[model samples]
Target: MSQRQRLWQRLTEAGIAPGCHQALLDTGRLQPNTLKLSHWVQAETALWLDGQLLPSVPPRRYWAYHKPVGIDCNVRPDDPQSIAALLQQLPPGVFAVGRLDKDSCGLLLLSNDGPFAQRLLHPTQQHQKTYRVDVDKTVTETMLQQLRLGMRYQAGASWIEARPCLATLSAPNQLELTLTEGKNRQIRYMCKQLGLKVTLLQRTHIGQLYLPALSAGQLLELQPQQVILAAQQP
Candidate 1:
Protein backbone atom coordinates (compact mmCIF):
# COMPACT_ATOMS: atom_id res chain seq x y z
CA MET A 1 0.00 0.00 0.00
CA SER A 2 1.20 3.50 -0.75
CA GLN A 3 2.08 5.52 2.36
CA ARG A 4 1.85 8.83 0.58
CA GLN A 5 -1.12 10.94 -0.41
CA ARG A 6 -1.55 14.69 -0.45
CA LEU A 7 -2.78 16.02 2.90
CA TRP A 8 -6.13 17.18 1.49
CA GLN A 9 -6.60 13.94 -0.44
CA ARG A 10 -5.76 11.87 2.61
CA LEU A 11 -8.29 13.73 4.72
CA THR A 12 -10.97 13.27 2.01
CA GLU A 13 -10.29 9.55 1.76
CA ALA A 14 -10.64 9.27 5.53
CA GLY A 15 -14.10 10.86 5.32
CA ILE A 16 -13.09 14.37 6.24
CA ALA A 17 -14.30 17.21 4.04
CA PRO A 18 -11.61 19.45 2.49
CA GLY A 19 -13.47 22.53 3.71
CA CYS A 20 -13.20 21.32 7.30
CA HIS A 21 -9.46 20.80 6.92
CA GLN A 22 -9.02 24.28 5.47
CA ALA A 23 -11.05 25.71 8.32
CA LEU A 24 -8.81 24.02 10.89
CA LEU A 25 -5.70 25.36 9.15
CA ASP A 26 -7.16 28.87 8.98
CA THR A 27 -8.03 28.82 12.68
CA GLY A 28 -4.43 27.85 13.67
CA ARG A 29 -5.58 24.41 14.78
CA LEU A 30 -3.54 22.87 11.95
CA GLN A 31 -0.08 23.79 10.68
CA PRO A 32 0.53 22.20 7.30
CA ASN A 33 3.82 24.05 6.83
CA THR A 34 5.34 22.38 9.87
CA LEU A 35 4.90 18.89 8.39
CA LYS A 36 7.57 17.80 5.90
CA LEU A 37 6.93 15.68 2.81
CA SER A 38 8.66 12.85 4.65
CA HIS A 39 6.06 13.08 7.44
CA TRP A 40 3.38 11.55 5.20
CA VAL A 41 1.02 9.17 6.94
CA GLN A 42 1.86 5.52 7.27
CA ALA A 43 -0.48 2.73 8.32
CA GLU A 44 0.48 2.94 12.02
CA THR A 45 1.01 6.66 12.28
CA ALA A 46 -1.42 8.72 14.27
CA LEU A 47 -2.29 12.08 12.67
CA TRP A 48 -1.72 15.32 14.56
CA LEU A 49 -1.78 18.96 13.58
CA ASP A 50 -0.59 21.65 15.92
CA GLY A 51 -1.51 20.41 19.42
CA GLN A 52 -4.64 18.53 18.30
CA LEU A 53 -4.75 14.85 17.52
CA LEU A 54 -6.95 13.85 14.59
CA PRO A 55 -9.15 10.82 14.77
CA SER A 56 -8.08 7.70 12.94
CA VAL A 57 -9.83 6.99 9.66
CA PRO A 58 -13.35 5.82 10.29
CA PRO A 59 -14.42 2.45 9.00
CA ARG A 60 -15.85 2.80 5.50
CA ARG A 61 -19.59 2.24 5.39
CA TYR A 62 -22.06 1.41 2.61
CA TRP A 63 -25.83 1.72 2.83
CA ALA A 64 -28.86 1.04 0.64
CA TYR A 65 -31.80 3.34 1.11
CA HIS A 66 -35.29 3.08 -0.32
CA LYS A 67 -35.51 6.73 -1.13
CA PRO A 68 -39.07 7.98 -1.21
CA VAL A 69 -40.52 10.50 -3.63
CA GLY A 70 -40.32 14.14 -2.53
CA ILE A 71 -36.98 13.65 -0.81
CA ASP A 72 -34.30 15.68 -2.55
CA CYS A 73 -31.03 13.82 -3.16
CA ASN A 74 -28.92 16.93 -2.60
CA VAL A 75 -27.45 17.44 0.84
CA ARG A 76 -28.94 20.52 2.39
CA PRO A 77 -28.64 20.75 6.13
CA ASP A 78 -31.39 23.34 6.42
CA ASP A 79 -33.84 21.48 4.20
CA PRO A 80 -36.04 18.92 5.88
CA GLN A 81 -36.92 17.39 2.52
CA SER A 82 -33.30 16.64 1.61
CA ILE A 83 -31.56 13.27 1.87
CA ALA A 84 -29.21 14.74 4.51
CA ALA A 85 -32.16 15.16 6.88
CA LEU A 86 -32.97 11.47 6.67
CA LEU A 87 -29.34 10.46 7.14
CA GLN A 88 -28.65 12.42 10.30
CA GLN A 89 -27.45 9.29 12.09
CA LEU A 90 -24.92 8.35 9.43
CA PRO A 91 -21.22 9.05 9.82
CA PRO A 92 -20.17 12.64 9.06
CA GLY A 93 -18.91 12.17 5.48
CA VAL A 94 -21.21 9.54 4.00
CA PHE A 95 -23.08 10.82 0.95
CA ALA A 96 -25.52 9.59 -1.69
CA VAL A 97 -23.64 7.81 -4.49
CA GLY A 98 -25.58 9.33 -7.36
CA ARG A 99 -29.00 10.87 -7.33
CA LEU A 100 -32.71 10.11 -7.35
CA ASP A 101 -34.67 13.15 -8.37
CA LYS A 102 -37.22 14.49 -5.93
CA ASP A 103 -40.05 13.07 -8.05
CA SER A 104 -38.56 9.60 -8.41
CA CYS A 105 -37.87 7.00 -5.76
CA GLY A 106 -36.37 3.57 -5.12
CA LEU A 107 -32.88 2.19 -4.54
CA LEU A 108 -30.12 4.65 -3.65
CA LEU A 109 -26.61 3.92 -2.42
CA LEU A 110 -24.84 5.94 0.25
CA SER A 111 -21.19 5.45 1.11
CA ASN A 112 -18.09 7.02 2.57
CA ASP A 113 -15.87 5.35 -0.05
CA GLY A 114 -15.39 7.97 -2.73
CA PRO A 115 -13.64 5.76 -5.30
CA PHE A 116 -16.29 3.08 -5.01
CA ALA A 117 -19.01 5.62 -5.63
CA GLN A 118 -17.09 6.95 -8.64
CA ARG A 119 -16.81 3.48 -10.14
CA LEU A 120 -20.56 3.07 -9.92
CA LEU A 121 -21.60 6.54 -11.10
CA HIS A 122 -19.05 7.45 -13.77
CA PRO A 123 -20.45 7.28 -17.31
CA THR A 124 -17.46 5.40 -18.66
CA GLN A 125 -18.16 2.57 -16.24
CA GLN A 126 -21.38 1.73 -18.14
CA HIS A 127 -23.07 0.39 -15.01
CA GLN A 128 -26.61 -0.75 -15.59
CA LYS A 129 -29.52 0.91 -13.82
CA THR A 130 -33.07 -0.42 -14.18
CA TYR A 131 -36.28 1.47 -13.77
CA ARG A 132 -39.96 0.54 -13.69
CA VAL A 133 -42.02 3.26 -15.28
CA ASP A 134 -45.72 4.00 -15.49
CA VAL A 135 -46.82 6.21 -18.31
CA ASP A 136 -50.17 7.86 -19.02
CA LYS A 137 -50.79 5.89 -22.22
CA THR A 138 -50.36 2.31 -23.29
CA VAL A 139 -46.85 1.39 -24.31
CA THR A 140 -46.62 -0.44 -27.61
CA GLU A 141 -43.93 -2.46 -29.36
CA THR A 142 -43.16 0.47 -31.65
CA MET A 143 -42.49 2.74 -28.69
CA LEU A 144 -40.25 0.12 -27.15
CA GLN A 145 -38.24 -0.12 -30.36
CA GLN A 146 -38.00 3.63 -30.53
CA LEU A 147 -36.68 3.79 -26.97
CA ARG A 148 -34.11 1.13 -27.78
CA LEU A 149 -32.99 3.01 -30.85
CA GLY A 150 -32.40 6.11 -28.69
CA MET A 151 -33.53 9.70 -28.94
CA ARG A 152 -31.89 13.09 -29.03
CA TYR A 153 -33.29 16.20 -27.42
CA GLN A 154 -32.09 19.72 -26.81
CA ALA A 155 -31.96 20.79 -23.21
CA GLY A 156 -31.09 24.49 -23.06
CA ALA A 157 -27.85 24.94 -24.95
CA SER A 158 -26.88 21.27 -25.09
CA TRP A 159 -28.27 18.20 -26.82
CA ILE A 160 -28.58 14.93 -24.93
CA GLU A 161 -28.69 11.48 -26.46
CA ALA A 162 -30.48 8.82 -24.43
CA ARG A 163 -30.76 5.15 -25.18
CA PRO A 164 -31.82 2.18 -23.11
CA CYS A 165 -29.97 -1.12 -22.93
CA LEU A 166 -33.32 -2.86 -22.68
CA ALA A 167 -36.87 -1.64 -23.16
CA THR A 168 -39.89 -3.84 -22.73
CA LEU A 169 -43.55 -3.30 -22.04
CA SER A 170 -44.22 -4.91 -18.71
CA ALA A 171 -47.89 -4.04 -18.88
CA PRO A 172 -50.30 -1.98 -20.97
CA ASN A 173 -49.09 1.16 -19.29
CA GLN A 174 -45.94 0.01 -17.54
CA LEU A 175 -42.47 -0.24 -19.01
CA GLU A 176 -39.31 -1.80 -17.68
CA LEU A 177 -36.21 -0.07 -19.02
CA THR A 178 -32.55 -0.55 -18.33
CA LEU A 179 -30.05 2.14 -19.07
CA THR A 180 -26.27 2.31 -18.95
CA GLU A 181 -26.07 6.07 -18.93
CA GLY A 182 -27.85 8.41 -16.56
CA LYS A 183 -28.78 11.91 -17.69
CA ASN A 184 -30.84 14.36 -15.74
CA ARG A 185 -34.51 13.25 -15.99
CA GLN A 186 -33.69 11.28 -19.12
CA ILE A 187 -36.56 8.84 -18.85
CA ARG A 188 -39.20 11.50 -18.38
CA TYR A 189 -37.83 13.47 -21.27
CA MET A 190 -37.72 10.45 -23.53
CA CYS A 191 -41.30 9.58 -22.73
CA LYS A 192 -42.40 13.15 -23.28
CA GLN A 193 -40.84 13.14 -26.74
CA LEU A 194 -42.98 10.14 -27.63
CA GLY A 195 -46.13 11.92 -26.42
CA LEU A 196 -46.35 9.83 -23.26
CA LYS A 197 -46.73 11.28 -19.82
CA VAL A 198 -44.89 9.62 -17.00
CA THR A 199 -47.00 8.93 -13.94
CA LEU A 200 -44.40 7.10 -11.88
CA LEU A 201 -40.75 6.20 -12.13
CA GLN A 202 -38.88 3.99 -9.68
CA ARG A 203 -35.32 2.79 -10.01
CA THR A 204 -35.03 -0.87 -9.02
CA HIS A 205 -31.43 -1.73 -9.78
CA ILE A 206 -27.94 -0.31 -10.01
CA GLY A 207 -25.40 -2.58 -11.61
CA GLN A 208 -25.92 -5.85 -9.68
CA LEU A 209 -27.37 -4.14 -6.58
CA TYR A 210 -31.12 -4.58 -6.29
CA LEU A 211 -33.52 -2.82 -4.06
CA PRO A 212 -34.67 -5.23 -1.39
CA ALA A 213 -38.29 -5.29 -0.21
CA LEU A 214 -37.63 -2.34 2.05
CA SER A 215 -40.41 0.13 2.54
CA ALA A 216 -40.01 3.77 1.70
CA GLY A 217 -37.93 5.65 4.28
CA GLN A 218 -36.17 2.41 5.24
CA LEU A 219 -32.38 2.09 5.15
CA LEU A 220 -30.11 -0.95 5.41
CA GLU A 221 -26.40 -1.20 6.00
CA LEU A 222 -24.67 -3.03 3.15
CA GLN A 223 -21.43 -4.96 3.07
CA PRO A 224 -18.65 -3.23 1.20
CA GLN A 225 -18.05 -6.42 -0.78
CA GLN A 226 -21.61 -6.30 -2.06
CA VAL A 227 -20.99 -2.83 -3.47
CA ILE A 228 -17.69 -3.91 -5.00
CA LEU A 229 -19.32 -6.92 -6.64
CA ALA A 230 -22.12 -4.78 -8.04
CA ALA A 231 -19.70 -2.40 -9.68
CA GLN A 232 -17.72 -5.28 -11.07
CA GLN A 233 -20.71 -6.81 -12.83
CA PRO A 234 -20.90 -6.81 -16.63
Candidate 2:
Protein backbone atom coordinates (compact mmCIF):
# COMPACT_ATOMS: atom_id res chain seq x y z
CA MET A 1 0.00 0.00 0.00
CA SER A 2 1.07 3.57 -0.63
CA GLN A 3 2.02 5.85 2.27
CA ARG A 4 -1.28 7.64 1.91
CA GLN A 5 -3.12 4.30 2.01
CA ARG A 6 -1.30 3.19 5.12
CA LEU A 7 -2.00 6.53 6.71
CA TRP A 8 -5.64 6.08 5.83
CA GLN A 9 -5.77 2.62 7.36
CA ARG A 10 -4.19 3.91 10.57
CA LEU A 11 -6.58 6.80 10.70
CA THR A 12 -9.56 4.53 10.11
CA GLU A 13 -8.34 2.12 12.72
CA ALA A 14 -8.00 5.08 15.07
CA GLY A 15 -11.61 6.06 14.37
CA ILE A 16 -10.76 8.99 12.13
CA ALA A 17 -13.05 9.57 9.15
CA PRO A 18 -11.75 8.58 5.70
CA GLY A 19 -12.47 12.09 4.43
CA CYS A 20 -10.23 13.46 7.13
CA HIS A 21 -7.31 11.33 5.98
CA GLN A 22 -7.92 12.53 2.45
CA ALA A 23 -8.08 16.05 3.70
CA LEU A 24 -4.65 15.66 5.30
CA LEU A 25 -3.30 14.31 2.04
CA ASP A 26 -4.96 17.16 0.18
CA THR A 27 -3.30 19.69 2.47
CA GLY A 28 0.00 17.79 2.28
CA ARG A 29 1.38 19.10 5.58
CA LEU A 30 2.23 15.91 7.47
CA GLN A 31 5.88 15.75 8.57
CA PRO A 32 6.91 13.51 11.48
CA ASN A 33 9.61 14.39 13.97
CA THR A 34 12.49 12.05 14.96
CA LEU A 35 10.82 10.66 18.06
CA LYS A 36 9.37 7.63 16.10
CA LEU A 37 6.84 6.68 13.40
CA SER A 38 3.86 5.86 15.64
CA HIS A 39 3.80 9.45 16.82
CA TRP A 40 3.82 10.59 13.23
CA VAL A 41 0.78 8.47 12.45
CA GLN A 42 -1.03 9.58 15.60
CA ALA A 43 -0.27 13.23 14.80
CA GLU A 44 -1.74 12.83 11.34
CA THR A 45 -4.82 11.00 12.59
CA ALA A 46 -7.98 13.11 12.30
CA LEU A 47 -9.89 14.19 15.36
CA TRP A 48 -13.65 14.04 15.95
CA LEU A 49 -16.05 16.42 17.70
CA ASP A 50 -19.59 15.42 18.58
CA GLY A 51 -20.87 13.50 15.50
CA GLN A 52 -19.10 15.75 12.98
CA LEU A 53 -15.73 14.78 11.55
CA LEU A 54 -13.12 17.44 12.17
CA PRO A 55 -10.84 18.36 9.28
CA SER A 56 -7.50 16.58 9.28
CA VAL A 57 -5.69 18.62 11.85
CA PRO A 58 -2.19 17.50 12.76
CA PRO A 59 -3.59 15.36 15.55
CA ARG A 60 -2.03 15.65 18.96
CA ARG A 61 0.25 12.59 18.65
CA TYR A 62 2.65 9.95 19.90
CA TRP A 63 4.74 10.88 22.94
CA ALA A 64 7.87 9.17 24.27
CA TYR A 65 7.14 9.66 27.95
CA HIS A 66 10.20 9.53 30.17
CA LYS A 67 8.07 8.21 32.99
CA PRO A 68 9.48 8.83 36.45
CA VAL A 69 9.43 6.22 39.20
CA GLY A 70 6.21 5.54 41.15
CA ILE A 71 3.50 6.21 38.57
CA ASP A 72 0.92 3.79 37.20
CA CYS A 73 0.96 3.29 33.43
CA ASN A 74 -2.79 2.93 33.05
CA VAL A 75 -5.28 5.74 33.18
CA ARG A 76 -7.02 5.45 36.54
CA PRO A 77 -10.46 6.74 37.37
CA ASP A 78 -9.51 8.09 40.79
CA ASP A 79 -5.75 8.30 41.23
CA PRO A 80 -4.52 11.85 40.93
CA GLN A 81 -0.89 10.62 40.99
CA SER A 82 -1.26 8.40 37.94
CA ILE A 83 0.29 9.05 34.52
CA ALA A 84 -3.29 9.62 33.42
CA ALA A 85 -3.25 12.85 35.43
CA LEU A 86 -0.31 14.11 33.43
CA LEU A 87 -1.70 12.90 30.07
CA GLN A 88 -5.14 14.34 30.75
CA GLN A 89 -3.61 17.74 30.14
CA LEU A 90 -3.46 16.62 26.48
CA PRO A 91 -6.27 15.49 24.18
CA PRO A 92 -8.40 12.47 25.00
CA GLY A 93 -7.92 8.83 23.84
CA VAL A 94 -4.15 8.82 24.34
CA PHE A 95 -3.00 5.41 25.67
CA ALA A 96 0.21 3.55 26.45
CA VAL A 97 1.89 0.71 24.52
CA GLY A 98 2.72 -2.07 26.99
CA ARG A 99 3.11 -0.75 30.57
CA LEU A 100 5.60 0.27 33.22
CA ASP A 101 5.17 -0.99 36.80
CA LYS A 102 4.51 1.87 39.22
CA ASP A 103 8.03 1.49 40.59
CA SER A 104 9.72 1.03 37.21
CA CYS A 105 10.49 4.09 35.11
CA GLY A 106 12.03 4.85 31.72
CA LEU A 107 11.02 5.22 28.08
CA LEU A 108 7.32 4.66 27.42
CA LEU A 109 5.44 5.09 24.12
CA LEU A 110 1.96 6.58 24.25
CA SER A 111 -0.53 7.05 21.40
CA ASN A 112 -4.14 7.71 20.48
CA ASP A 113 -4.77 4.71 18.24
CA GLY A 114 -5.63 1.32 19.79
CA PRO A 115 -4.38 -0.70 16.81
CA PHE A 116 -1.08 1.19 16.62
CA ALA A 117 -0.49 0.49 20.33
CA GLN A 118 -1.23 -3.23 19.86
CA ARG A 119 1.31 -3.68 17.06
CA LEU A 120 4.15 -2.49 19.27
CA LEU A 121 3.21 -4.14 22.58
CA HIS A 122 2.10 -7.59 21.34
CA PRO A 123 4.42 -10.25 22.86
CA THR A 124 4.39 -12.53 19.79
CA GLN A 125 6.62 -10.05 17.95
CA GLN A 126 9.33 -10.45 20.61
CA HIS A 127 10.62 -6.90 20.31
CA GLN A 128 13.86 -6.54 22.27
CA LYS A 129 13.94 -3.98 25.10
CA THR A 130 17.09 -2.81 26.90
CA TYR A 131 17.14 -1.68 30.51
CA ARG A 132 19.58 -0.13 32.98
CA VAL A 133 19.33 -1.76 36.40
CA ASP A 134 20.78 -1.03 39.83
CA VAL A 135 20.77 -3.74 42.45
CA ASP A 136 21.47 -3.43 46.17
CA LYS A 137 24.75 -5.36 46.00
CA THR A 138 27.59 -6.07 43.65
CA VAL A 139 26.92 -8.56 40.84
CA THR A 140 28.79 -11.84 41.20
CA GLU A 141 30.34 -14.06 38.55
CA THR A 142 28.08 -16.95 39.55
CA MET A 143 24.95 -14.80 39.29
CA LEU A 144 26.01 -13.48 35.89
CA GLN A 145 26.67 -17.06 34.79
CA GLN A 146 23.23 -18.20 35.83
CA LEU A 147 21.58 -15.31 33.96
CA ARG A 148 23.28 -16.48 30.77
CA LEU A 149 21.42 -19.78 30.91
CA GLY A 150 17.70 -19.08 31.14
CA MET A 151 16.59 -19.44 34.76
CA ARG A 152 12.99 -20.18 35.73
CA TYR A 153 11.22 -18.12 38.39
CA GLN A 154 7.77 -18.16 39.95
CA ALA A 155 5.56 -15.16 39.21
CA GLY A 156 2.00 -16.40 39.83
CA ALA A 157 3.34 -19.35 37.80
CA SER A 158 6.70 -20.68 36.67
CA TRP A 159 8.07 -18.75 33.68
CA ILE A 160 11.16 -18.44 31.53
CA GLU A 161 12.00 -16.96 28.16
CA ALA A 162 15.61 -16.62 27.05
CA ARG A 163 18.24 -15.74 29.64
CA PRO A 164 18.81 -11.99 29.88
CA CYS A 165 22.12 -10.40 28.85
CA LEU A 166 24.28 -8.00 30.82
CA ALA A 167 24.51 -4.95 28.60
CA THR A 168 26.84 -2.62 30.50
CA LEU A 169 28.06 -2.76 34.07
CA SER A 170 28.40 0.80 35.32
CA ALA A 171 29.52 -0.10 38.82
CA PRO A 172 29.76 -3.26 40.92
CA ASN A 173 26.12 -2.69 41.77
CA GLN A 174 24.88 -1.09 38.56
CA LEU A 175 24.29 -2.99 35.33
CA GLU A 176 22.29 -2.89 32.12
CA LEU A 177 20.19 -5.76 30.81
CA THR A 178 18.39 -6.53 27.57
CA LEU A 179 15.56 -8.97 27.05
CA THR A 180 12.89 -9.71 24.43
CA GLU A 181 10.17 -10.59 26.90
CA GLY A 182 8.32 -8.13 29.20
CA LYS A 183 6.74 -10.41 31.76
CA ASN A 184 5.58 -8.84 35.02
CA ARG A 185 8.66 -8.00 37.11
CA GLN A 186 10.64 -10.52 35.10
CA ILE A 187 14.03 -8.97 35.70
CA ARG A 188 13.37 -8.36 39.39
CA TYR A 189 12.36 -11.97 39.98
CA MET A 190 15.39 -13.20 38.07
CA CYS A 191 17.65 -11.08 40.21
CA LYS A 192 15.97 -12.19 43.43
CA GLN A 193 16.63 -15.86 42.75
CA LEU A 194 20.32 -15.02 42.26
CA GLY A 195 20.63 -13.11 45.57
CA LEU A 196 20.28 -9.63 44.07
CA LYS A 197 17.85 -6.99 45.27
CA VAL A 198 16.78 -4.53 42.61
CA THR A 199 17.19 -0.89 43.61
CA LEU A 200 16.15 0.64 40.31
CA LEU A 201 15.14 -0.60 36.88
CA GLN A 202 14.69 1.71 33.90
CA ARG A 203 14.06 0.65 30.32
CA THR A 204 16.26 2.58 27.92
CA HIS A 205 15.59 0.94 24.57
CA ILE A 206 12.84 -0.89 22.75
CA GLY A 207 13.52 -2.51 19.40
CA GLN A 208 15.57 0.02 17.32
CA LEU A 209 14.35 2.96 19.40
CA TYR A 210 16.07 4.71 22.32
CA LEU A 211 14.92 7.24 24.85
CA PRO A 212 17.63 9.81 23.97
CA ALA A 213 17.92 12.69 26.49
CA LEU A 214 14.25 13.23 27.11
CA SER A 215 13.89 14.00 30.85
CA ALA A 216 11.46 12.67 33.39
CA GLY A 217 7.84 13.48 32.48
CA GLN A 218 9.02 15.05 29.22
CA LEU A 219 7.62 13.78 25.88
CA LEU A 220 8.60 13.84 22.22
CA GLU A 221 6.50 13.07 19.14
CA LEU A 222 7.70 10.20 16.93
CA GLN A 223 8.20 10.17 13.17
CA PRO A 224 5.96 7.75 11.26
CA GLN A 225 8.85 5.67 9.92
CA GLN A 226 10.18 5.10 13.46
CA VAL A 227 6.96 3.36 14.41
CA ILE A 228 7.14 1.30 11.19
CA LEU A 229 10.69 0.25 11.98
CA ALA A 230 9.64 -1.24 15.34
CA ALA A 231 6.53 -2.89 13.87
CA GLN A 232 8.67 -4.59 11.22
CA GLN A 233 11.26 -5.83 13.76
CA PRO A 234 11.35 -9.54 14.59
TM per candidate: 0.83, 0.70
Cα error, residue 212 of model 1, in Å, equals 0.7
What are the per-residue Cα lDDT tens digits for candidate 1 across 1-234? 734444664566555665587776567666444554324555345566667666665566898899999999987879999997876678766778999899999999888765677678888888898999999998888888888988776666777888555898888999999998888988888888788999999999888788978999899888767776567665
| Clash list (residue pairs), candidate 2 | 36-222, 36-223, 37-223, 37-224, 37-226, 37-227
| Alpha-carbon lDDT of model 2 | 0.68
> Model 1 Cα displacement at 50 (Å)?
4.6
Error of 1 at 2 (Å): 5.4
Q: Output the number of the TM-score-best candidate.
A: 1
User: lDDT tens string, model 2, 159-229?
Assistant: 66555554557789987787767788888888887788899999988777778588888888888876665
Output the worst ten-in-a-row residue range by lDDT, candidate 2: 29-38
Instruction: Name the best candidate (by lDDT).
Output: 1
Misplaced by over 4 Å in model 1 are: 1-50
